[model samples]
Every structure is written in structure tokens, then in C-alpha cells.
Target: MATKRNVSSTKEEGPVIDEAIERNWEIPDFTIKEIRDAIPAHCFRRDTFRSFTYVFHDVAIILALGYAATYIDHLPSAPLRLALWSFYWIAQGVVGTGVWVIGHECGHQAFSPSKAINNGVGMVLHSLLLVPYHSWRFSHSRHHKATGHMTKDQVFVPHTRKALGLPAREVDPEGDGPHSALEESPIAMLYNMVMMFVFGWPLYLFTNVTGQDYPGWASHFNPYCDIFDSNQVSEVYQSVAGLLATIGLLTYCGQVFGSLAMIKFYVIPYLFVNFWLVLITYLQHTDPTLPHYRENVWNFQRGAALTIDRSYGFILDYFHHHISDTHVAHHFFSTMPHYHAEEATVHIKKALGKHYKFDPTPIPQALIKSWKTCRFVEDEGDVVFFKN
Candidate 1:
């Protein structure tokens, strides 16, 4: 493992920014291989049976919740049924989202060593959730490759003042502008929560809504979209086929069980899964304390380090499969399975020391903070930090 040198000087030479984020700006003394070496070898190995166990476990809970929700649908009181249904959807939906995470692991080749098993399982699982697996996998690889690069990063790239057509000094440096007001407003929080959790995922995939722009428009579903090159077109077509097959299955379900039944049992939970997916990714990357680098300053270690580790409490962590809390490690080592992320993250944190970011800001507060303050990046720096 190659070790970095002159870390103290390197730390000082980096662009000056928010002291909070600048503290982590210095290149660490340890290298990626050293960080990997700290983790037990077993942590890097994929366990196919164990990975499948997690999938089956989440699916079992989803089925149980669905059955229970159906039984509660018979309740005499409308309010009781409504409350129970709401709880079931959130619970089952979150669990189903974990299923999606498992498939995502398959995409990263963290689920197993066999590419055939990974693609087969990921395609089936993501397709069931109305996601195009190969399409996402290809684009997501781009994201991991260039995580904090202001221009090259694929998703959740903060808009610049120019991009938003605002003047350079329009946003107050003192943090008391309209953005601050929005941050403190309950209505704004509610509005942001609604948009982020409800429509954020599909809009992102369909239109590249929060993503960085290519030469033209980009959509994950289009095989010919710039998101993929000609070499990768066939795989994207396979992804489209998976999506079409899922649509056919859902249509068949609607015909057999009635549209309302389909909505009650599947659609609501599907939306919830999307909500969780969007919320997780958004919060992971968007933070005032994180920096976005232009090409000249961006490096893989810095880009990967830009991710924040969030706590969703114990039960939510289980439902999310710890993706929220262990995301920093995942970014650093994309193929590390969720089951091993905690261990790897612990080692990385110790190795990285002050550079490791673990934000204890409650998720709701963090969401509001980012929505308000992380609106855009500095207009003219090689290393730009977020501002309102």
C-alpha cells in the first residue's frame, strides 16, 4: 500500500473554505490500500448465501406486512384502517427499499463474485421496484468515479449561482438571506420533504433532475441517452426490457386484482421506496460542510471523502440496511458489501481521523439545512463549497 507524504503541508496548500470542511481538506497520510488493509480480509469477500439471506429476509417482512395490511383493510372503522395502512406502507416500503439496496449491492458486485448472479438478481429485484438496473448501474458507476467533481460528478451536483441565474453576491455570506428564511420556515421544510420524498427519484432518473448536465439532456431509461456510450447500448436495452417486463407484470396484477388493490398493495410502497432512495442519496452528498471540486482540484480520495455518514437511528438503519450510516465507506470502496461497511468505516475513520465526517445532525434538521444552505456552489473557485 502506497502511503501519502507531507500531509501537514498538503493540508495547508488546499484552497481555503469553510473551516469546518477545510479541516477535512488535507490529504490524509494513509492511502486507499492502507485503509483497505486495515479491514479484515473476510470483510472484502462476498458471501453469496449470506447476501441472499438478507434479500429473502427483507422480502419475507414485506410479504408479512402486505398480508397484515390486507387483513386490517377489513377493519370496521375507516380511520383505524387508514392509520394501519399508513403504518404498513411506510414499514413495508422501507423494507422493500432495503431489497433495492441489496440489488444495488449486486450492481457494485458486492452481492457475489459471479457477474451472472449479480446481473440476474439485480435485474429482477430492481425491475420489480420499477428501476432499470443496468441503466442505473452504469450511471452510478460514473457517480462513484467522480463523486465530488463539480463538473464531472453525475448526481446531486449543486447548482452554481450562474446556473441558477443569480448574481454572485445575491446570497448573503452572513447566511441571513431568503435561503435562511426558507431554512427556518416550517412550510418550506414540509414542501421540501414532500417533493424530495414523493417525486425526487423518478424525476432524477427520467430527467436527470438533480444531476449534472451532459452536452444534451440525459435520461436513465433511454438506451441512446448520453448517459451511455454506444459500447454500453446493448446492456441499456436489456435494462429497458427489464422495465417493460415489470410494467407488464404490474398491468397483469392490476387486471387480476383490480387497480385499487394494486395501488394499495404495491404502488404506495413503491413510492415509499423511491422516497427512501432519494432521501438517502440526497442527504449523503448535499451538505454545507462538504466541498465540491472542479477538475483541477478533484481526486478520487477527496471525492469519496466528500460523503457524509448519517444516522437514521437503529430501526431505520435496519430498514435501510445501514446504507445511510455507512455511506462514507461505500463511496470509498464501492464494492464493499453493506454487511461489512460498518467495520470498514470504523477502520477508515480511525485512519482518516479528523478527515472522517460523521454528522450527528438529526436527519430532518440536516435535510432542512442542505435544502436551505446547499443550494449552490461558489462561482469561481477550483474548489467550491456550498452556499445558500
Candidate 2:
């Protein structure tokens, strides 16, 4: 819990996001207490009216998409039907999931002024999509609060080299490790493109593959009630409702589109959603150059600031409400609504200047690059690369 870090840099590694101390500057104790503890003023300048409008509009779109799926799907001709199917599946899956992230903001209570509103909105949308709203909210907030405190961090803790004859690496993906296997994937290379996009979220919460450990009281799998536990009744009930809704959707599609057409409708677009979701989450973090801290040296500011941002296209950007674009701001001020995120981010960058990290590469290329570069490399024994 060191509070102060030397802000000077003379090394030539080209602005990587490592939490390690650099050699040229003296590494000071960088506790959270030292890092401009004031929440930025920009955080308060939320255009709540506009954000509410956007949220309202996004909710409309979700209903509209579902309506489209349910009724007046497409023209009956084979080619025309195929075209409509292609448009909806591809558009809805990738783009639809983007709105879901906003719903995720609701879970974070970052979308609105009221916790009831946030939870209500999050509950509806997330439960509709099979996400256990309260479960994710509680867990995700823990991730933010304890971002890099090794002893108390929720997810993504780096494993030390000496621990398993490896440098500080990502913690184990299997049982008894940092997070569950479903949370992070060994196959993260094409993760968003296919593997995780389709199966990642399902496996993680349901199976607890790479998820955080809880005492028996908090298990997500159990349907029993417990306050302050992530795996609890609300999660179970909401998850059941979401899953049942999905089944109902499939059943409806089977009746209308026929078994084969329903299969096409259900699977294809869903693939796009999973792919993009996985990809977005992946590139936002998970760089080999980014260092994870150990118990003594970890700090939240350093951990949250270690994110990398890249530009996605305009169409996707509008659909997702720049959540991808505004994630840096989100990390810094988790309570800011999505609409205000862009404005807040602009100000934050101005203040941060070079302290900010950005990756100018396009998403496709970065995905390819990260695939090759970011595979399970552990922490280094020597702290020189991470020197202060």
C-alpha cells in the first residue's frame, strides 16, 4: 500500500502500462493515498438529461431488436430472408451486446443518479440477457475497489515468478487460482472473435471456471439468499429467469423460422456478440508490457491507469455509446454515466497528458498482435524492469 510514485521517466520502452517501478526514477512508496486522491471535477459534470435520454433510447432499441426478432422478421424469399437474417444477427450480436455493456453500467450504478434506477434497469436488461445483475455488480465493484491490492484484489492478480519458478505471471486459470477459467481464457487470441464470445460468459458465472472464490455463503450456483455474497438468491433467480427467457426465445424462433432457421437466427448473431464482447474486454487490459503488482507494491491508481485504448469504427462506436471509447474514464470514475464519459474522458486526458496510455492500432490488428504476444507469460524475478 505504498502511496507515492516518482512521476519522472527516462527509460525507452515507449510508454508501456507496467505497474513496476522504472530504473531511471527512484521508486517511491505509491499508495493510493498519494495518487491525486481527489476525484476529478469532470466526474461531476454529467449531462444526466442527455445520458438519461441515451439510456431511454438504448432501452427502446433493445425492445425494438427483440420485437424485430419476434415479429415481422424479414421478407419470405430465401435470399431476402437470408439477407435480413445476416443483417440482424451480425448487427444485433456485435452491436446488441454493446448496449448490454451499458446495461452493465447500470449494474455498476454508473448509468444514473439513483441506485434503484440503476439496479432496476440493470435487472431488467441483464436478466433478459441471462446476466445475474446483482451478482455481477457486487463482483465487478470489488474488482474496481481492489483493482491491484494483491491480498484483497477481486480478479486479474499477477502471479510472482518465484511462486511457481516463473516471474510474475497471470494467476492460475484453474481452480484455487486468482479468478475462474471462464473469466480469462487461455484461448484469448481469437477469444472475442469466437470462443469466449459464444461460451465465455456462460461458463464463467455458471461453472465458476476462472472466477473468484467465495465462502459457502456466497456461491453463485446456489439459489439460497445471503446478503454481501456474490453467489446468492438474486443472482440465481435472475440467472434462471434470463436462461428461461433465452429458451423461450429459441422456442419461439423454432416455431416461426423452423428448427434450421431458428438455429441460424440464434447462433450466428450470438457469435458476433460474444466475439466483440470478449475482444473489447481483452484489449482493454491484457498487454504483456502491462505489469501486475505484488502484495507490498500494489496501488489502485496504478492498476486502473494501466488500461490501453484503441479506436473501433464509427458504426460500432455509436451503437456501444463509446463505452469502449470511454472505458478509460470509466476506470477512473466508475460512477460517471456513459453519456458524460466522452466529455469526462477528454478532460481527464488533458489533465493526465502523457500519463495516459493509448494504442493507436485498429482492433483487428491488435487482436492478432495480442494473440501472439499475450499468452500466460509470468512476472520477472528481477524488479529492475519494474523499478521506481
lDDT by candidate, in order shown: 0.82, 0.58
Candidate 1 local lDDT, 44-126, one digit each (tens)? 88988999999889988988887777788678999998999899888878899899999999999999999999999999999
- At residue 170, what lDDT does model 2 achieve? 44
> Model 1 lDDT vs. the true structure?
0.82
Model 2 clash tally?
Answer: 32
Q: Distance (Å) between predicted and true CA of 246, model 1? A: 0.9
Runs in model 2 with CA error above 4 Å?
Answer: 1-49, 59-81, 148-193, 212-219, 223-267, 377-388
TM-score against native, each model? 0.91, 0.72
The residue-by-residue lDDT of candidate 2 on 185-237, one tens digit each, is 54643455465557765665665433444445444445652323544555556
For candidate 2, report its TM-score.
Answer: 0.72
The lowest-lDDT stretch of 10 consecutive residues in candidate 2 is 379-388
